[model samples]
Target: MRTILQRVQHASVTVEGEISGKINHGILALVGFEPEDTNEDFEWITKKIIQLRIFNDENHVMNLDIQQTEGEILVVSQFTLHAATKKGNRPSYIKASKPDLANEQYEKFLQILENNFKAVQKGIFGADMKVELLNDGPVTIFIDSKNKE
Candidate 1:
């Protein structure tokens, strides 16, 4: 599993000209699943995302998790996160999970977040989505389950 977390003042996803998911003051989570990803990977990443102290506190220190600041989460499935571009100009998604398997994993990942976090909104799987966000602090983070970083 590979994920990118962006602290955002606002974020939204539109599918087919209709807004599907939206959030205010939260993390925009762009998630991807590899073919070999297991439930443990989802759980681990979910826990890390929920616990990450990226938001600032009273003393202006980055010491608060999302919940502490009452932030929401907007998740979008992005298989391209696993794209391999070492060969040529064209990138290959060979490391990404197949659509069916990935959709299942995406659902499981969302379920984990919904259960453990506050407000969680998600984009449709396998849909052409238009996502917009006002990045907060421009603070971005990347996590890869395989690397455990």
Candidate 2:
């Protein structure tokens, strides 16, 4: 599994002129699943996300986690995050999990995240979506389950 986490002041997902999910003062996560991803991967990322101390504290230092700030979450499925572009101009999504498997993992990830968050929003999996967000601090992080320092 791979994830791109961005701190946002506001975010929303719309499909067919209808707002499906939205949030304010939270993190927007773009998640991707691989064939080798398992429950452990989901657990690890979910814990890290919720515990991440990127929010400001009383002193305006980035010392508070999402829970401390009572922030929400917006998780969007993005298999394209696994695209491999090492060869040629065309990127290959061969590393991205198949839709069936990816969708299953995606839902599992969302469930785990919501279990620990105040509010969680999600984009429709495999659907064309228009995502809008006001990135707060423009703070972003990329995490890969297989990469451990």
56-84 per-residue lDDT for model 2 (tens digits): 98888999999889999999999999999
Model 2 is weakest, by summed lDDT over 10 consecutive residues, at: 110-119
Question: What stretches of model 1 exceed 4 Å from their correct place?
Answer: none
TM-score of each: 0.98, 0.97
Residue runs of model 2 more than 4 Å from their true location after superposition: none
Error of 1 at 145 (Å): 0.8
Error of 1 at 74 (Å): 0.5
lDDT of 1 by residue, 101-137 (tens): 9999999999888989969999999999999999988
Q: lDDT (0-100) at residue 62 of candidate 1? A: 91
Cα-lDDT of candidate 2: 0.92
Identify the candidate with maximal TM-score. 1
Error of 2 at 102 (Å): 0.4
| C-alpha lDDT score of every prediction, in listed order | 0.95, 0.92
